[model samples]
Target: MSIKQFLDKILKNWPVKVTCFVMAVLIYFFHQISTIDKKTFVVPLEVKSEGAMVLSGGYERHRNVKIIVRARAEQLASVSEKDLRAYVDLSSQSSAGQHNFPVLLDLEERILLMDPLEITASPDSVPLSIEERDVKFVGIRPSVSGIPSHGYTLSKITSDPATVRVEGPRSVVSKITYMPTEEVSVQNATSDVTKKVSVLNRNSLISVGTGTFSVNARIVPQGMVKTFSDIPVSFDNLRDDLAVSGEPVFVDVIVEGELLDIEKLSADSVRGSVDCSFILTPGHYEVPVSVTVPLGLTVNSKSRETLSLDVVLKPEETLPDSSAVNDGEEKDAENTQPQEEMEAVPEDVTDIPQSDAVPEPQIQGV
Candidate 1:
């Protein structure tokens, strides 16, 4: 049939032609609504900057900063939070000086204009330090085996710090001679423990990621730790009554839970402390301890441990009274007193160009 004939037949009834057009228009509208009923839009993510480029987002808000978006109920009911993802692209981050950036949404060609094209972030840019992390896993070789003095054995000598993380000028951490552990001079070490130990090689400028921040090695109790033969516990300050104690005194050390917990089987979770300045005192005392285990590591203490600290205390009765000293002797006493010194910071520091560069990943949140 010719085109004209077909048209004439279809349009023979003016009412029917008008009705058909109206029906087709209604179907189109219904189709649009149907899409709305099944699809959802992703909420846009805004990157806000403070004074610095909070590198890779931090804290709780920054970590999940990528917006949680979905289509209106029609399209989103079937989708899940797990199905959506907002990613910040670092490809354009050429040099990393605070720059407000957006994460692009790449849709599968079938979608249309139901979503907003872009959203802005706050603070805009953050102070960034683009530098390579001097990450090194230094092995802690405990020379003393962390065992106590005579007549005792370390049933188990695990370190609260199983691993030591060091970050500094790549060159520095790489050349490190050793990762040492502060002596835990216990007469007998049994069970597990959590102790806060300062990882030595102090360089305050160098930021330690707080993991195995200290070094510790388990002692098999092979033999007596020769290192303890002469570590005279200096009693610079002690009372007369508490002075004069025994050798290798077992110090009942109490520590917080969590530190001695290392769920990992076959590994010791022994913690340590560093204090050359811990003025040797008289009797056993429980002091606030600081532990530096691996960073981002949470502990579940299974066994509690104690510290057998053998110390030497000088009582007042054993020494001559100050009044008994002649003027000349007193002058000599003043000169004999040793002056105290200040502690320095850890030396190895990560070399990220601050202010002018993108921050090296804090990984604290990572």
Candidate 2:
């Protein structure tokens, strides 16, 4: 066809052609809108603080944000909360005060491939309190609960890291004197108990360099002291013919042991003895008093460490038969004269002269 004829034919439907083109563009835009899908996610919000500054006070460190993301249906299916990040930078905040920063979002490489992507967060900005960062070293205190086993007691508590470094706002860091660990149970424990425990961060504004510590609790038997009075001392290894005289020696003993063992002890339970094996002859001697107690008991002291006593040799004697002795006494009584009759004769003899009384008959025995 000729140029003049083609121009005429194209100009003839120009208005109609323009109307059809606008309608087609509208249809395509609506089709694309229908294919795009919106997904909402709850993602953690992070705060960035450069230099010597940090978020402080009631500000939440891991704040959750509700975000709506728009992309193709296939692309949105692969999108997850992990693929999105929201944060607010506090590095520009030079002074210590409350400041508002706009929350910015970042998408991962996979999510970035989706063309015509749209993202919007409910809270576009957040208010935060910025403060100068401070660090301090504080001792660690272990917290314990429950009791040890019966007849046992808690002795000492220790931690592996005696001290830890704490970092946070100047106000919060300065107020902390010591860090306390989570409660370590020693219930029914007989020996030493060691456990790994986390340090309790009571204040949300502070951060600890060491989050966990090893805590050791020492358990030992309960100890008590008891005094036993008047414990008699016995002599040991004495000769058969030797004996102890002048009253048995008694001593008071002080003993230490477990509470249960000490409670069951008495004066009779303890024995004190003096060695007499070395003493050959009987005489006064100073000897040490040795005491013996139960296996778990320890002797603290004795009222008398050494006692003075007398040792003597046993006396020997022989007795006559009782029946023979009694018979002989009875015969002597029969042959004896009355005292009154003898006295009467004596009076008569007294009247005679001493020379005549002396001339009495003398009998000689065979």
Candidate 3:
């Protein structure tokens, strides 16, 4: 038949043409089904704190969910794990506590176009802890560990934002004095270092509003040793009855540090003092001289670390006697004389005669 005649023959019966058109559409869809493929993906799941309460630690699950999906072979090849995600909305919740919510998937236009089937997840629900959110500003401090290099020293450490805003549960917020960052190391470092670090979480109940901070530390090489003379020393806790005096009222302090630190060294910067709380005796003793300086500065005093000071009891004032003054030299001379005079006895002795009749012994024992 001619082309025009073939078309006319096929369209002559309207019911027959309609039936053939339906069969063609069914066969096309059936062929597409035969090429369908199934895939399983581990998609990250997230929870939304849509209500007045906040999620503690901003969702604490450490694992993702497993999802099984069916799509056309060609479309399945193009899909990836990143393309699938699941989340649960907690907008309907009004109270705070633990709750189990069903996981939900957000449908993308591309995903809908693939005509996905059997869209199911292994874990359809997850548990979360919610608490009343509280926010406040707290001071932030950077914590450092480990010592610097042998020849170097750490001069100063500071943070960009001294205070940060933190939001968390009431219990956690109440106990938080300050936010601290992760430990920074200065071991073997000889120069300045600045870095951005995250604030460490004290517990699982609170979150920091300003999550990161800039910390800077200054380190320098050991400088020349400088000695400061005429630094006055003071004593404390002296006994009330004791009077203490140091041999040298002024002391000399020696400090070794960075060049800049050594340049800044002065009599005022170096504090000299002695603690006299231990001095209970009244005598001459050596007391330790304590010298204080700024950070990164070392005081060098080993053998001559002490100062000699004399601690003695205060002398009592003597009052003159009026009666003794009145007595004068006359009373003094009279008192010098003895009450009665006595004759001196000789070394050698002779025996006396009885009743003047017997002769005295000539020799006597000496």
Candidate 4:
């Protein structure tokens, strides 16, 4: 059959054609109505400021609004938080004060609005205090806690970015002088360490550009033992009448510290002593020796761990005896009695026995 003849045959029935056309129109309208939907969403209400300014003072909290949008069901199903944006324009508010503004909505092509969405904010209009935003560079201070392991000491603690930029409302930014990092612990740290530490947030209004910083700590081994000999040992709290003497008058002190500190030490820098305050009576004792050193130095061991002292009481004076004195005087008198002196004999002359005739021969020789 020819195309025109077939079309003429189909159009031959006017009432049937009108009914079919009306049915098709009704189906399209019903489909369109089925796809249309109304949904209520809670979205953040952001404020777009014209210049570098912030909302300060009275209202410190952020605001959110409830929006009812009319859109196709398929598009609404695929919609996300980012797709719906609500904001209050603050371009006209250039000075610091209170002001009321209208809320604006940004939507996509699929979204349709039958009527304005009703926002149940505490204040339907935006009421805020505007202030100039200020930024300042403040030093970051790190707080250290705990001690290092044995035989090790902390040498230095530092941060990579010593200072950070803080941007916030003028009042809050001016109040902040310095920023501080979270407390870092060096407990049981035997060697050098580096870590990332978060900066503490002192105030919510103030925002720090750098949230985290690097912290490094240096640990070094304590120097070798240094021995200082001949450190004079002294006694304390001894009685006046008692005398104390130790076997070793001096002691050897061993200390461990930094190399520079240990090198500056000498025998005279250390003092060793034993307390005798408890000894009321004189006797011998083995007392523990205590040593003292300069700052930045630690006492480890001593050559003479204990001191041995012989404490004795001074002797009392003896009383004079009357009979002994008299006997001494009589002896002295006997010794004073006259006595004959001995004469030397010549080498050539012969010695003769004492006799009365010898005395007469001596008178003849004279």
Best of the candidates, TM-score: 2
Tell me the tens digit of each residue's lDDT in model 2 across 1-366. 999999999888899988999999999999999999999999888877776888885466448788899999988998888888988888877889888788889889878778879999878888889899998899999999999998899999999888988988898888899999999999999999999998888887778875679999999999999988899889999898988888778899999999989988877889999998898989999999999999989999999988787889899878889999999999888767576466665434445566666566999999
lDDT of 1 at 124: 30
lDDT of 2 at 296: 85
Predicted structure with the largest lDDT when compared to the true one: 2
* Clash pairs for candidate 3: 223-257
lDDT of 3 by residue, 22-125 (tens): 99999988987798888898877776665567766436563578888898778888777777888877765667887877888875668867765557887888
Identify the superior model by lDDT, candidate 2 or candidate 4: 2
Candidate 4's error at 300, in angstroms?
A: 12
Candidate 1 worst ten-residue window by lDDT: 224-233
In Å, residue 138's CA in model 4 sits off its true spot by 0.5
- Which parts of model 2 have CA positions greater than 4 angstroms off? 1-25, 226-255, 270-366
Q: List the residue pairs that clash in candidate 4.
A: none
TM-score of each: 0.28, 0.66, 0.49, 0.49
Worst 10 residues of 4 by lDDT: 114-123
Order of quality (TM-score): 2, 4, 3, 1
Name the TM-score of candidate 1: 0.28
Question: How many angstroms is residue 7 displaced in model 3 relative to the true structure, after the best TM-score fit?
Answer: 33
Candidate 1, residues 235-276, lDDT tens digits: the string is 333344344445542212222322132232112233433232
Q: Give the winner by TM-score: 2 or 3.
A: 2
Candidate 4 structure quality by residue, lDDT tens digits, 45-76? 78776577776643445467767655577556
